[model samples]
Target chain A: MSTRISLDGVDKTFTNRRTGERQQIFRDFSLTLAPDELVAVVGGSGTGKTTLMHLIAGLERPDRGTVSTGGTRPRLGMVFQQPRLLDWTSVETNVRLAATAAGIDTTEVAPILDAVGLTEYARSYPSVLSGGQRQRVAVARAFVVRPEVLLLDEPFSALDELTARRLRLLLQQLWLRTPRTGLLVTHNALEAAFLADRVVVLGGRPAEVVGEYRIDRPRPRSPEDPELFDVHRRIVAALT
Target chain B: MTVTHPVGAEEVVLGGGRSPAPPDRPPATGTAARLTRPLPALLLVGLLAAGWQLMAHTSDSALIPGLGDIARNLADITTSGALGENVRVTLTRVTLGFAAAFVVSVAAGIAMGRSEWLRRFLEPAVLIGLATPGLVKALLCVIWFGVSLVNPVLTVALAAAPALTINIAQGVRAVDPALGEMAHVYRLDALTRLRYLWLPAIVPDLFTGARLGIAMAWKVIVLVEIFGLADGVGYQLNLEFSQHNVAGVLAWTVAFALVMAAIEYGLLQTLERRAVRWRRVALR
Candidate 1:
């Protein structure tokens, strides 16, 4: 039996008491995430794709809905756009924090840090690390715990183009290595097409699933691949 | 670790020790720049002292205490244990007041920062406290607790707490919301999250508030002491003024200023440097 996430009839809203303004971000939003499935959520900024993941991650609660994973509350792991690495902790200690939280041993940390290629700077503070290195630390922290589901919220948005591309490939490899459910949210259509097995578009004030596409491309995907261009076009069409 | 690609000519990536864009365009590695920078402050101190000594000699003035006279007075007071006793009283009261204010301020700040409703209601109250004249509060303290160390300490705490709370709440507010969400999803243990995430995020803010707390506490403490009590450096200066001894009053004021300066530059500066060494790289 593999892990699965189901969100049913979710409603979320926020009201400014002083201005008497109410913004309803999502109403009757529903989603079902398949086990070990790599899905990309692509949308324009402020589509509440991040908010959707927040709901699924339980960082937030929907004003209305029942959300579940594999008939239970599964462990959640996340990579934010900014590295969000704790400034005081070293790269290694940060990864260790995740595993230790889930009642794991210190032994796995070294290997996981090695996987992210940050073993050399294990004790270096986040302040000293480069932007790309910081994002790698974020990825390492997310992957170390081996959660039932992983959420990436524009995880490569801050990196330079070359760095982002490299990380995108590494993320593909990471998803392959673990049988964990993965949901990546991004505004970049090319990134969505390249990394995800399925693509989803979220938009509107009362956000609904606007579009969906499936990529039948092979592993070691090439940027020049004709099939990727087709998927990319469909995703771009969904954005506007 | 030494692997370096090309950085801009202006940027000193790791240890190259040059910064970009100061109009001089000096070789950042040159001793000339370093030598010129300290000259102005040195000259200013020198001139002030020379002018003070000159004025004292010309007027044969007892009222405008000369630099040497103040120094001798400091020595006399310290040796007689009068300075030490007064300092002990002032410092004891400051620490008690600051600690109490720190505790209350941090709790209220965090509460206000975390909740909009709480902030909306309490923010005005905090501002009111901050807006009220600190001496007025000191007067209130005298009325309530009478003329004692406790009264002054209470005055200082009331004056300091609201501002400290506001400073800290702004710091908490400034923290990236994504980090909070990330912490929750990572499921970091409460203590670990605090130590790793919350601590660094708030340390700069907390330190700022602590700095203000120390300053306000000392200032209010001394003023309250002078206004009500009959002991301490403040009161001694008060007594000196009553006797029409301007030199003595000037000497006591100098002593209090030096003490406050010493606390800030010596203790708090050292602690801040140690805690946030990362900032020095940029500032330097």
Candidate 2:
């Protein structure tokens, strides 16, 4: 079942060990996602985009306030900036491990691998796969869990332009097939506009939502769609 | 209207650039290349043997034993079955001591690596342990425990634990934080994290610590044996030295070294290769 995620009045701080400098990343910051909605968070470096994801994923706790998934502890699947696959494990085993962790059936692994076009490389190690292929396996791993909330932190930014573009389309397709609550944190405004049901731009010290835009376009929207460019332009303007 | 796109369209895009075929198989080597691989080590051993023989012939000193003399003494010990008994005794001591040291080091290493306060608290003890000479430890063990089995075993464990602890601590610290984060998000249970993530991640370090620990254990075992114990390869070495039988001492030393080398190459390295096979593929 899909789940709604909300972070209310969250506060987070990081202290530098060497310099003894305390930097506040989020203060009184809040955001929410409707059930089965895909929201992309776009911001510059050090704007707490990742911190926001971490707070939602329960990797970090807020100094104040609560991050709740509709009061239910929903299964979570995350795709990091790096593929972050276990190099020792096979592609199929990687997805199966996530499924096992989520208490889902391991049988879902093969179809997800097939969905990512990595069926043949199931037995191959992460080392042998190309960067894009490894990232595809990561996507398969996240989806196979049937997680109620999907968190992707700049999942395609490491790839070259062409591969990133294709993966963006692939991610959109996967989401369309099994829509769930999703948060994609990226610096790419165009990517945010192309994939997210809503694009929320975060900015300033102790980051807050600077702008929000809804993509009213239907599923399988083209990257080349002129309306996407207009939304991308507004996102970039908000970013500045 | 919703845009209708076929799954085939996505496949066409994904198929456009197949990643250049993975060089899954390593490049084949010629017979000549394979044959030459061990040539340097073999040549060095041969040269050293020849040089030692030449020295024995040139020098009439009783301390400089000839290769033939050493071989004859080695044969005498082997034929009398003393060699095997002494080797077994020494090996048992080393193994027990190393096992004890390994368990303590891994536990302490993980604790120190995971907690800053523990690291700071334990740093002085580790540094002191590392700085103490093996000979001093052996003498202290002899004084504390007398001429018994506990003397050598305790000395070996104490001497070896510090270096292994440092190695394992570094490994624990070096574990990728990203993977830990991934594990957290995935909700992997504690046992699963240890098995699939922590154990595999620290395997290289474990091997490093084991190798260092075993080597140090061997050295400390010998020291304590020579200092106090009545029987073992090291005690036999002391006996030969007291009798001024240089060849006897040299023969015993060579036999012990051969056993250590065999254990290292035959057991430890083979296990390491199997555990980290994924690394070999990644490197290729």
Candidate 3:
């Protein structure tokens, strides 16, 4: 009853045109996340990490079995690798778009922008904003929906180290403020260790869960914390 | 014309207000910057005028009238009120033709772009339509509609529609699948999907199609008018040609060229800026 997202024996495959090869991304994979648990799914580049997120988001359907969220169709929010903001519209309108699509009041737009530290940028177009700022707006747009299940696909991977660190902290704060069941697909073990209640490593040719670690230590745990560092090391070891 | 967005220029976002930048330093200036400015466009025009004048002086022919004679004819035509009336007639034809072409082509383009079945059914016909000669269309229109307002307008639309269709179809096909996936994930409504994802994705191609459509419309409208219709600048040009009034031909041409320039620089450029202003920032 507490499960927010359940993938039951999912299979996904894609074709390579040039080589005429069929690459299987996932086969007989299953994942279940409890409500309000932040799970970080980490894997190598081509190991079906993003594919898993896509399947859950319903952007990609499973070839076999089912990928169900909440009830029939749970409200979903996503922060892509790129900001994916509407370039023609202003930042406020971009956030407002998701809210509007969800039939949430326009009033939530201002406060969400404020929370993301983008109040001044509300009227500014996405093109004018820095990469980091654009990503922040995307994050704000994702959070505005108060989604039943939030999916992030390497959301901080594109940012530089300092900006990535800052955004990681920002993402944590936002998630804490309104805790939702979420899946963050990331390559960064440190990021996985810092954010997730449980870190799942996906590996092998047709990726399934290779390893899972419980970071039982409470959050607001520092990057410098010895216990957190130990978890980060174990996750990285599993990924390699 | 050289279009410059000053480094750190405050753009007008939604609700039409510029968020001011810090006025700490004056905009960047250098020799390269000054040379790259739009002033060079005027210099190019001056050079072209000088070349034209020199050619007229050397040819010593009635067909190639001096610039001065052309200017005088322009003034005479303006005072007589024929220039305005002819321009109005021509523009009306172009507007009707372009509007019709735009609607039909965009609808067809979207249909073809979105569906494999529709694309297969229509793409060959569309290609043949594009390859069809404007002169052929003009003559056919004249035969069908007679030498009246309908002939020129219909001919322009038929002649121009293919280019718009082709361009818009290509634009729609070129839409980023990543964005499409994003829209799907977010579960945006059809209208919102079109407005945000589809429109922005197809904009570059749409503008290209519009430019091509307008240009073709101008050419087709004038051709039909010159051959069949009794009014408009093209008809006047035909009349001047029959009368051997070379100066009059040049004068009418100048008037039409000026209007086209105004449309390009004044209207289209402004619209392009507003539509794709985000690109400027993204590029920087």
TM-score of chain A of each: 0.95, 0.98, 0.96
Name the candidate, 1 or 2, with the larger DockQ value.
2
**Once superposed on the true structure, which residue ranges of model 1 sit more than 4 Å away at CA?**
A12-27, A43-48, A70-72, A87-90, A93-107, A188-190, A201-240, B1-43, B146-149, B188-199, B202-208, B227-231, B239-246, B282-284
Per-model DockQ against the true two-chain complex:
0.28, 0.37, 0.34
Give the Å shift of residue A175 in candidate 2: 2.0
Best by lDDT: 2
Q: Which of candidates 1 and 3 reaches a greater lDDT?
A: 3
Any residue pairs clashing in model 2, and if so which?
none
- In candidate 3, what are the lDDT values of residues B110-147, reduced to their tens digit? 88888889989989988887898888888889888987
In order, the candidates keep a fraction of the true contacts of 0.27, 0.33, 0.31
Off by over 4 Å in 3: A1-3, A217-226, B1-62, B110-121, B147-150, B172-175, B282-284
Model 1 Cα lDDT, one tens digit per residue, B1-284: 11112222232112123112223322445788867866886798789879988999898967777887788877777788888898778777887888889889877887787788989989998989888887888888888888766797788789789878988888888888777777788777778765777657787888888887777777788778878887777778778789987766777777787788788767887788777865543244
What is the lDDT for A41 in model 3? 94
The fraction of reference A/B contacts recovered in model 2 reads 0.33
TM-score of the B chain in each candidate versus the native B chain: 0.78, 0.86, 0.83
lDDT of the structure predicted as candidate 3: 0.82
The numbered model that scores best in TM-score is 2
lDDT of 1 by residue, A113-167 (tens): 6766777667766666678878888887887787788889899888887667767
The Cα error of candidate 1 at residue A100, in Å, is: 4.6
DockQ order, best first, reads 2, 3, 1
